[model samples]
Target chain A: MARQVAQRDDLLPVLAETFREHGYEGASLSLIATATGLGKGSLYHFFPGGKAEMVEAVLAEIEAWFEARVFAPLRQDDDPAAAIAQMFGTVTDYFRSGRRVCLVGALSLSDARDRFGQALRRYFALWVEALTEALTRVGHPPEGATALSEDIVGGIQGAVVLARALDRPETFERILVCLRERARAA
Target chain B: MARQVAQRDDLLPVLAETFREHGYEGASLSLIATATGLGKGSLYHFFPGGKAEMVEAVLAEIEAWFEARVFAPLRQDDDPAAAIAQMFGTVTDYFRSGRRVCLVGALSLSDARDRFGQALRRYFALWVEALTEALTRVGHPPEGATALSEDIVGGIQGAVVLARALDRPETFERILVCLRERARAA
Candidate 1:
């Protein structure tokens, strides 16, 4: 049975899951309605701009979550190593240890990128930036830190792809461990 | 007008691009017909099993191309370092320096993965395996070689995602250079 959503914000996670499961193009309004237990009328009332608006709200929520939980900590926390460690843990939990898809990354690969390109770009760019700051704080040189941050961020995205493709969550876990070690040694 | 395709094999690339542009679910029959300049009847004549068959044929073509161009050289070439270098070159060209999406990687992230999971798994597993062999031959220890192969393969896939997300082909190009160097150092 579909669960009731009490508020507009309550729909964000459900919408995000729908997008992750079926992708932006595949997630039909009907599928979303089915997922959220909301009729088309109610859905329209919540998101007058339709699926695009719903996705936008979802992306905003995701960005906000990352900012508070991952990015801000990476940038503002005094313990650089601990902050990086926390970032990895938060990411692991967020991605459900590779069982969940990165909706932004998935959309970036699909035609929806043409429409939501800016949001997608910002999601990744901010991640790389925040991580670069964290790495630099850990005493790595700026250029090397930037490159390593990109590698770690991109590596996480790719590990999710591979783990899902190979149906092996261990693959994701193993890569995360390696990445964590590399960051520590950096 | 769509270019004439005299052979069944000729349709593979068009199908691949259609899937890349629109994704598996988004690439409907009409869109494919429009892309190929073929009517419904002709498309059916060529792919009696419909879109699924067409996708299967495309995947097969991709696997064959990689096997001959990338995997075979990595596994069989006497100069492992050169083979690894050639793999990077082939991959960069194949992805069109990040302008082109990795269709297999994209599929692995979408709902289509439920249907094409095995093929997706084999595609990546084989690449990692072949590259591991090349790295080992290049003098890296067996365990390290395998892990490094995973990192490099996953890095490429992630780089593609990041490059497209940011609309910066240079992101992909830079990562490829880094991965190439990493492989050489390994």
Candidate 2:
């Protein structure tokens, strides 16, 4: 019984990685089964609604992770600079310094956005809003804070795309450094 | 006949749009046929190598357009600032002020990158290289030029993702305005 629960919990990361690497449309049931080391019956037992349920659970886990580790700190931390700095570090580690794709960002670019629009929208929106608040606390005017927040958030997403396109993880790291400098100077 | 040639040329944009809206893996031949108003037999006649051939043709057309309009201008234009400004204008128009997805950028984030790695890499690498050259002419040191080039290019791609994710095209346009301001300052 305990093993069953652990197996279900462990399946989320594998599913996330499968979607990240293969994308929603590209990650077929056979592929998911292969990645999770589960048969179709086991998968359906765990996720009756199938792939959509699997993706929903993955998105939920991702959102919960960011909210606890990243967003809440940006909004609630006493030190805005520290919060922003931590965001950079956490983000770097989260994306594996560019070796990993942003599953949410990748989904946003694909037609899967249509299937998960609200969750996708909320993820990025909460991020920008939280960072904008942090930037405002950092002494920028409201308008500048908002614009800069968008740039920083959008810039990170773009850097991921460029890094993957170039097959160069260092590109992602370099851009993060530059963005860090800009955020610090701000 | 001339009509057939024109149909082939016109088919490129439709195929690009289809792929842009529905990713490479999601875009089936039936979808392509519906988008291009061409039957499978005729599509095969034009692209004997199948969907791969069609995508290759689209990539070639996109590369050619950027070469003539964006990249060549960045590389050869006498006025660096003017060239940069013109690039902003052309890119905005090319992306339809954030309403259009960058097909290459989208593909880079998908599993399709594995299949079209060379063309995908060349498309972005050239854009960054040409932009870096233009930024160098604007007086930035080589390293700074390259970093800024990546930031600008990546930022644009990210903005598209954000715009689509948030269902707000203005987010994209707003980011572009900020990027343009940064480029001018550089």
Off by over 4 Å in 1: A1-5, B1-5
Q: Write the per-residue lDDT of candidate 1 for residues A62-113, one digit (tens) a residue.
A: 9999999999998989898999999999989989878899999999999999
DockQ of all models, two decimals each: 0.88, 0.85
Question: What clash pairs does model 2 have?
Answer: none
List candidate 2 segments past 4 Å from native: A1-7, B1-7
lDDT at A97 for candidate 2?
72
lDDT minimum window of 10 residues, candidate 2 chain B: B1-10
Q: Which ten residues in a row have the lowest lDDT in candidate 1 chain A?
A: A1-10
Score chain A of each prediction against the true chain A by TM-score and list the results.
0.96, 0.94
* Model 2 lDDT tens row, B72-154: 98998999889999998898888876677899998888888888889999999999999999988888788688888999999
